[model samples]
Target chain A: MSWGPLALSLQVALAATALATALGVVLAGVLARARFPGSDLLDALVTAPLVLPPTVLGYALLQVVGRESVLGRAWESLTGSSLVFSRSAAVLAATVAALPLVVRSARAAMEAVDPALLGAAATLGASPPRVFLTVTLPLSRAGVLAGVTLGFARALGEFGVTLMLAGNIPGLTQTGALAIYDAVQANRDAEALGLAAVMAAVGVAAVYVGTKLGRRRVHGA
Target chain B: MAREGGALAVRVRVAGPTAERPRVDVDVSFGVGLTAVMGPSGAGKTSLLLAIAGLVRPLAGRITLGGSVLFDGSGSWVPPHRRRMALVFQHLALFPHLTAWQNVAYGVPRRSDGRDRAREWLARTRVAHVAERLPSTLSGGEAQRVALARALAAEPGALLLDEPFSSLDGRLRLALGDELKDLVEALQIPAVLVTHHLEDAQRLAARVVELEAGRLRSERPEGA
Candidate 1:
């Protein structure tokens, strides 16, 4: 409900969505394109975050990037930034929570593209990279759009990971979801209700768009 | 892995499941003109074309076009795009996002003249009127014609078609067959077409190549 925390949440959520979408795409592309031993294991690892407890994930992030660990030390030396209570940390937690959804949608979209189309592109003298860029990517555009938006919405609404990893720093790491939580504790029902309504709207819109885009191309796709 | 060749020598070794012979090996040398390949379902006919087009990795054998070995034992392999040959898949994998003309242009090498060549090919294949339409919107016959135009637009060293007319109605198939024959003769590029319909091939190809299991007949022409 605090204006400062609410504003910060919006900014952090937007940045988190952007970073996560980009990372998710690269990750999804690899998951879709590559084949190797233990591929199933790799898939399980990617999707594990969806079902795992957010607090556990936050702890894991802290262990690895919490100022004392090697990665944390590298971040501190290079950027003079400790992730805890920082906007970047909020973004990281949000990304982890939303990554699997984006990747799964992207994978399904890429798979739905007819294999024959790729073969035909090759026959028409398109190099492998050309075929993917020209044919595969365009065909999967809708799915990618849906995936990224869903990821963004998920990240925007994440509470537990954001709270534990980034902490509830006003105007820095406190997201709208986090703002609502704090408002409830402070007994400010009005602000909490407002934030909840906004989050619900965002969640509904993202879900609607994702489903429509995916279904529009599902048949004759 | 034999590379002994006249013009085009292809040896394919691959078999689909449920196939009596999983290792259907086909060895054939084509000189010129369209060589129609006829066989029943699962006769490894499509595999032979895939091997020739450099799409399928033959279990073991060799394929050479104009004495340039595309594939051979051990380390010899050529990428399909570099093979400079066009293939018309049975499913007609037209670029759904592009207009028919754009699809044709995709086959032409990127250059200043690419557009003009694309238009010329479209006109030759008689799909110029519908060049602006996306492949998704085109009728089955129109899509096939656009595909043919795209293949010819490449000015490929050869043409390979897997069940080229399988989707067409009887009348359309016969008409396209006649038109296709004329197109191939005018270009003078050798070709291979796969089909379950013997009558269609007989009308189009000058020579008929038959495959049984994976083995090609010693020397014979059936129907086509």
Candidate 2:
């Protein structure tokens, strides 16, 4: 009945969602607009995380950021600690797990924007970046919000990757999902059920909000 | 202030034989007055406008506005936002999320009085009453005026209108057309009006050019 895991999960999920949303929206905008050779290949790479197994993704992450790796060495030198098995690792794991959902949703939304409207903005002497800020982003707000909501749900539920990278350190890296797992394995059925019910409720609420936002059309379009 | 001189000189070939239309080859110049472009559907009228506005890249030839070379057969090219051209799309294309004043404000240069400038443009276009409303709630004529206000607020070097009055009733069309004529005259910037209606062409333009299958077919002075 300890609330530490639940609190840690919320903290990790919020940080992960923020990181995912920033990177995902930019990547989605690039994928939606920029035309170049191998653009489709690039898109496939971004989407690969969604279809790949979490264990596979975790392994890949370990290779990139594990101790003795360049990033890990750099982090240790800079911060006096290894990055793996830390709260930051949990955040990274959740970010990667949540990214594809945001990217896919935001890309579709951006692509759906009327090209004519973009042209009109340009003709009004707004630069490309200005047009994106004033026209493109506002027009696709709902979709982006939906993606962020879904990404939060995904990030909160992340267990396999979190376990692999962050490990289940009580009151530290152990998030709600890992706590549920730990509780069940330790025969703490009441604790497990309580955490599971809360997780389920949050997940459902996030998904319901996401769906509603996704279905909303920009008024006056 | 009306621009004293510098016509938009265009001599370009746009390569396109899409499922809907043939390639466009046109050589024309627009002076400081309204020039109407008339053609049947799929005649590349929109393509020509897009090329001038720097939205479409032409395969060959050059486009010069006054002394500034916007595009050339070579690598010299200017992006759309730098072209100093304002195009009012046929569908109006007002930013749906913005109120009428904000839509116009978007085109106003960044300055301390930008909002006031936007309000002035809206009043000039007779849409000041609807300045706070989103485009969706505006009537057809109201939307058209808002679009016009947004375009003019940019203080562009040239103005382009694509079937600007197509959706309005006859009376409203005439009224808006007259207002457009006065605006273009006052600005003294080369204005290109693309329309399928001959009457509209004759009424607003000092010169009219017809296009067919993406080529300039004929040119005539208004009333000729």
Candidate 3:
């Protein structure tokens, strides 16, 4: 029956989606364009979260951001902010859940761009950065946009990682999914059903948009 | 004009997959105007331009543009953007995300006060109408013009093309070929165009260099 928990989840999902997309684009560019000895390994490493269970990722996050680990200590020292058990932790969890979606889409977009166009840009005297920004990025935009939408939707549905890592703090860490869980446990049937219906509608819209964009890509080919 | 330097010189040796295999070896001097480079499949005509553009490295060779060394053995290679050489790829690799003008803009300096010049370049190439559309929306011939316009925007010391008119229909190919020939000469930069089609070679080039099995066997004028 807590509207506050629902709002927290919504904020986490939205913020997580935005953060994941920013990292995803840069990761996709490096994966697709940069050739290094461990490039493929790096790609696999980034996508590792997709196959990992959320609980396991939560456990890993607990270790890395527990205020005891070196990285966690350094972060706390630098910013005086504890990410663990906070809304930021929820965002991080959602980002981990959604990252694969964005990176996959971005990689496909980068690949769809014709290499010849890249070549022409290079020959036209554009530097590597210029060519990628002006030609490569613009060409594979549909894929990148599609990927971002899907990542956001996926983040909205993330459960285990957000619950464990952020501890479902009422009105802060509780996302829409967690709010539904909370309502179900407390026997608040009407509020649970309402939130479920809204979530279902959002889910349907996301699927519909993703499917339409996918079809356009197939036809455009 | 390239006349002051005599010709654009390249000695390209490309090693792919291994250091043991004999790389694609080519040494040639191209004159002031258009020179058609005809070769069989896998003959490495495209490889030559890639080396000049700094897209590929020659195990041992040198490329000099307008009497300035662009590449030499042992890591004396210039970056592609600074080489002052523009290339039109056989695939007509126009930027799909950008409108035609934007693609052309990529070739020139970012702060180039040359908006009018870019517009005029599109007009001259007869693609001014499509200037607002992305490359994906363009027909094959239209994409080719955008590629050429982007190259022209750079105004490089040498112009290299890999199958400039390969994908177009006959009429379009011939028309674009004529226009490109006229334009490259007007600019007076040394140019090298590659093709398997003798017709494309003859129509656009005054002299021809034939490559077979990674070697330049002969050079001849059109039809004799």
Candidate 4:
């Protein structure tokens, strides 16, 4: 079996999960703590991807970052390459598909942290940033870790958005899921089965790890 | 400017959650000793402490610490971190993820021998041997001591205790209160202890202030 699809799949999922985790953590922190008008509306928008059609999300991405869009034009000019139908495009697709998983899980985790602990930290002379890094972030480790794992699993299996934004370019944009699709289309049953097994194994592993992490609550936390 | 080791004057009003009692007000001052704020449940004693600690915003009034303007009605308020005050929570809230030593060291600045200072405070509070233990591993009394040590390790300008002995048994509460009173006196800083128990308040402070229905009622010397 060729290693190209597996390698590309891992690369895209890793990049996507990393991006999602970064954005998700900051967004979750704010969402968990802030009380302002329209906070609920903003929360719904962030998690909207979970319920929205993947193709619709992909179409939205295309309208904003497609080759003809301003961002895409600038990106292409700077990088001397088109943004769509590339490995980075696959990463972008995977990121969008995985973002809601990260945000929902992380926000829940952050919200579970006791406000009293934050109050104690502040009284002990820790600034807001210090309190978050030293107290809030450390205490929310289980949720953050679980969120990253779930996001990675989602990214690994992302198909619809990827097909729309990054197309299945063999040995390039073809992730494990995309490769399985290609194999089945050509009636390559053995290759399809192999790729499917690999994807399933990855998904199962991610889910198992995430479950264990999320369930391991801290006593007195 | 306020004098060093001077009093903390608090005269503030905060909006409560309901329309019936639209506001809660606190009016008091502290010199260099423990001042217990005693009240029954829902009397807003803790709210007064929170406002002084900068954890809550007051709708009007001011809190002056050692003559410095900690908060003023004219849109001037210092954030909690810069307030130079330490609060010991009833539940202890001893950073469950950190060991006793780490929790004590948390507020100490990284510079100026903070680790040694933490160890010193831990020893002072009689919890030096449990320095490596997590909060969950420690008993209620041990955790309380650690909380006190952590607060003192910060070398704060003031200290606030919110029902610090509420979790302990009756016997333990008295014993711990005696030890705490001595500790607070040794530190020579203004301290506020909020408690629903009259015994706890009288045992720990020479002056006691009473609150009822979100309003400060009376302050008197221990016997009165």
Tens-place lDDT per residue, model 1, A3-88, is: 67656666776787787777777777667766878878978977988998988888888998898899888888888878677888
Clashes of 1: 3
lDDT of 3 by residue, B1-224 (tens): 23243368988778855665444788888878899999888887888888878887788988887768889996787888788788888776665556788777777654564566578789989999988887778888888998888888776788888888888888998999899899887888888899888988887799999987678889888877
Give a tens-digit lDDT track for model 4, residues A28-100: 8889999899989989888887888988988998998999999999999999999999999999999988888
lDDT order, best first, reads 2, 4, 3, 1
Give me the chain B TM-score of candidate 4: 0.94
Per-candidate local distance difference test = 0.80, 0.91, 0.81, 0.88
Q: Who wins the TM-score comparison?
A: 2
Every candidate's DockQ is 0.56, 0.87, 0.43, 0.72
Ranking by TM-score: 2, 4, 1, 3
Give the TM-scores of the predictions, in the order they appear. 0.92, 0.97, 0.90, 0.95
Candidate 4 CAPRI assessment class: medium
Per-prediction count of colliding residue pairs? 3, 0, 3, 1
| C-alpha lDDT (0 to 100) for residue A179 of candidate 3 | 81
Clashing pairs in 1: A9-A175, B24-B214, B202-B224
Q: Indicate which candidate wins on lDDT.
A: 2
Candidate 1 Cα misplacement greater than 4 A, ranges: A218-221, B1-6, B15-20, B221-224
Predicted model with the maximum DockQ: 2
Q: Candidate 2, residues B1-224: lDDT per residue as tens digits? A: 44445799999888786634447888999999899999999888999999999999998899999999999999899999998899999998989999999889887766566799889999999989998999889999999999999998888889999999999988999999999999999888999999988998998999999999899999998987
